[model samples]
Target: MAAAFLPPSLITVIWGFIGIVCPLFAKGPNKGIIQCCLMLTAACCWLFWLCCYMTQMNPLIGPNLSRHSILIIAKEWGNEITNTTTT
Candidate 1:
């Protein structure tokens, strides 16, 4: 959906600017090192943030039900199981 893609697009643009544009302004003998550091930092931050965002959108874990819990719930909630016979 447009909603899902929009946030990532916006964030990527921001990070792209930080990594690509900010490096151009670096000065002195350590300019290359600064640029590399900025780009790597941007990339790592983007990757980590994207991973967390996707995980929140689709969780990896879920609740599990066992036979004991099912029976307990059925009894406490007054639910009855029925048997059907077909001839």
Candidate 2:
């Protein structure tokens, strides 16, 4: 349960830190564009993760959502593809 939240949350924190630190080290004429792009990317990453988290928590959408279930499904799909293809 907790493990499911770690990846996206950690990524959001990392991006937030980058967004803050990038502007401080910015130099030259392209500095403004660089800072703006970094900040925009960070914002998008945060928002996307937030939406994912919210959807996972929503009872109406997925009452018993689990990261393990998703992983299992992905693993099964991979196995199916691997078995279908011959080398």
What C-alpha lDDT do the candidate models reach, one value each?
A: 0.90, 0.77
Off by over 4 Å in 1: 63-87
Pick the lDDT winner.
Answer: 1
lDDT per residue for candidate 2 within 1-87, as digits (tens), equals 898778777887798898898778888899899889888987887888788877766656535758667667778787422324448
Tell me the lDDT of candidate 1: 0.90
Name the runs in model 2 displaced over 4 angstroms.
Answer: 1-9, 62-87
Candidate 1, residues 1-53: lDDT per residue as tens digits? 89989999999999999999999999999999999999999999999999999
> What residue pairs are clashing in model 1?
none
Report how far residue 87 has shifted in candidate 2, in Å.
Answer: 48
Name the top TM-score candidate: 1
Q: What value does the lDDT take at residue 57 in candidate 1?
A: 93
In model 2, how large is the Cα lDDT of residue 81? 22
What is the C-alpha local distance difference test score of candidate 2?
A: 0.77
